[model samples]
Target: MSYKPAHAGSGPASNSLRILETVARFGTGTTAKEITDALRMPPATAYRLLNALVGDEYLVRTSDLRGFALGHALSGLVAAATPPTVCTAARTIIDEFRQGVRFAVHLMMFRSASLRVAEEDPDYPLHSVFELLRYPHASAAGKLMLAELGDPALALPGGQLVKVTDHTITDSGRLEEQLAEIRVAGQASEINELEEGSASLALPVQLPDGSAGAALCLTGPAERFTAISEHAEAARELTVRLKPLLF
Candidate 1:
């Protein structure tokens, strides 16, 4: 995990970045000599750039050992580069929901006990509340995603839950009880847990095998998202209407 010096030259560094970008776009490794030939740089300069990239963990030595390829450090960046399958399919539903509610609509994916907001509507207000975008099991969407891990019926993985907000449920005992409620209701709700005066309603997006792939959420001011409020009802209705697209 060696790091480059802070005062590296920008001109040559920019060229190296261009080389990495080309390799990534091509989806394969390129030999240092090949890169030099392509970019019209000297062989020694190309080798220096390649080793620099390798040390940064953005590239790995290929099987040939003479070439370099993208590494796992680029995996998270790539995953975030494209919208997930569920989000791509549910875009219409999400857009309409955001338009109708005039509030933020977030699509969250479950990674262990945490919920990561993979997609959000830019036009939707209250953007700062979701600025961090990723959080532990606290919001309605987070809880809905967490509930997937407890379903004996779904046979998903289980692990120690991580708490992100003051209102987060850390105890396994209480979490299991709450998950049961999510299983029965097919949805979850949270009020002022992640942020004071903010609330949300969320329902699991079940895949073809009946396993939860993600959660669909609508977030807004607490006063606007009551238990039996029209906003909540509309979000629930949107979730139901979007069900067919998940497959």
Candidate 2:
């Protein structure tokens, strides 16, 4: 006798499970349209399932209300199912950097045109946790990833360059120039861009294939990061320490 998997075909339960899986795969959460396109499910059906999942605490809408991520219940499930070694290593590295720099540190991975914070310094929070996801164009780590992506990165939704603050670079032409500079400099910095009082410095973690695997960032009060020489020095030091651990 042969047995069939419960999720092998289309049904309310099967589709719900598939939607959960799809959202999980997206490191930075996913939009409704993305779910529809990925699963080839009807838009109405997708929305209904998403709403149900959100209501049942299996999924939670992003802080921007534009995407969905694993909710508390689902996150706990995933945590219980996976090993803790990777999380431990990530936290150790971030903690060490935070201790050395005395600033908030974050580990960000750019995937599927989104910036996902894999780990962050809990002792010192800079901006709203969701702010990075919503305003990638206004952040140093985001600019670094965009620089690595080159022209193709411009097609991402964040490439619209929404102005998050008065200092944000909303003009596409100017933003492109900034990206170029970051590429040449091998690092990126933003002062009062994402927020009025905050600044950040980011450097790329070079992968084995010579591509940017992730971004290591330090953020703090704008006053502390306003000096170019200081920013460069800190970024260089952090990059040296991160390279051995991450790559």
Candidate 3:
């Protein structure tokens, strides 16, 4: 994920903006389940919303039968919508987390209705998976962001669960259960779901309205991250300390 601010070329997004944006961002067709995993909406809600978008011609169905992309008419709308400002507000906190964690750190905004990486540090030498946000249930950041939706502590797009990895949580019932736990715990963790032998810790960035506007994460190899319990503890502390900056 590259850290960048919203530009003038961006446009305003509506409630249904995610459906089109997800397709454009991911650059591939997506299923309702994938949308739900990335956006954190209930399965039924995601299905209904995506269906509506398709019906309205804001999204187009793909040949695979379970994927969608921006409809012909909606492409220009995304280019005009502003990327989002949450990144600007939280960049300091995100950078701090990276410095302390000594690993790649990324911040993802709940944009258009999906999790979009708003920033990533170049010093870490890891590519930000902001692109994967388009592929629901593809990464730890996506799952954490989706989990935050139960509390709307993280703004999320609505869609069904999509499976990206063998370890990825594709079962809606189980994924919901995991999200409930994350909401109560104030954070979430994942191993090898996004990438094999990789682990991560994440927490939601809440807005003044108590909505989760984005998520902050620390990621690295499984060995380095798993051995450092202190890192997890510190990340937890950072999330709590930064709560004021977000909410």
Candidate 4:
């Protein structure tokens, strides 16, 4: 069961990382014996590294405790390292839309259990109130994410539908209804919901896997986006521009 290193001259740390990478590539799970066979390491060395990784929470033992899978920490590391390509494409589109529409634009991604502003128009920055990652029920972008996530997402801790303004939807039941409507309409909108005199229109960015990846939004004075036709046109244009980049 003992063997030499698959990659000669590699240090213990490098070997440890390779072990992790190998386990991830398996997707289902991997046994210590399997790892030893793949890496050509001694069975004792492979078992030792696997035990250490499981101890540190970088890898987790399967239900039977005979195989290893990625732990929460490793999953988080992967998510942090892999920035969604849609965010980059959305940023470019937001910048261009900002120039043409003369409105503040934002690209929001749902990450780490929060709606994060991944990118915003530099020249026309978002107002201070809309800067932080909060108010899911009040902002068009946040509402869009909630709609995509569905009921299970609402059950998460700290996911209360807080009222940010008089217009904000506070009741869970009502909010669910609105989310359903947004899902059907294929767009979301907010008029003075996050802040008085501010309005926003957000359309979902479809990921390659067909899930909602992010929301591309335009925000400005309420008067500017008051017309339903304007929102429809903007959503249509954004979807058309984002199609090639996304798929």
Best by TM-score: 4
lDDT preference between candidates 1 and 3, better one: 1
What's the residue-level lDDT of 188 in candidate 2?
A: 87
Report the lDDT tens digits of candidate 2 across residue range 62-160: 889999988887775665444223346656656765666667777786655457776666887556656677677788888888788787345356446
Off by over 4 Å in 3: 1-81, 86-93, 125-131, 151-160, 240-247
TM-score of each: 0.55, 0.61, 0.57, 0.64
Report the lDDT tens digits of candidate 1 across residue range 109-223.
6544344566666765434344234543556776776677664223222444445556656676876788788889888887766776777777777767777767777777888
- What overall lDDT, based on C-alpha atoms, would model 1 receive against the true structure? 0.66
Better of 1 and 4 by lDDT: 4
Worst 10 residues of 4 by lDDT: 152-161
Q: Report how far off residue 67 is in candidate 1 (Å).
A: 18
Cα displacement (Å) at residue 183, model 2 = 0.6
- For candidate 3, what is the lDDT? 0.63
* Cα lDDT of model 3 by residue, 122-231, tens digit: 77644535426655355666666666555332332355555556777767678778878877776777777767777777767676776666676777787876654457
Q: List the residue pairs that clash in candidate 1.
A: none
Between prediction 1 and prediction 2, which has the larger lDDT? 2
What ranges in model 2 sit over 4 Å off? 1-87, 152-155, 227-247
lDDT score, candidate 4: 0.75
Candidate 1 off by > 4 Å: 1-89, 111-114, 125-134, 151-165, 227-229, 244-246
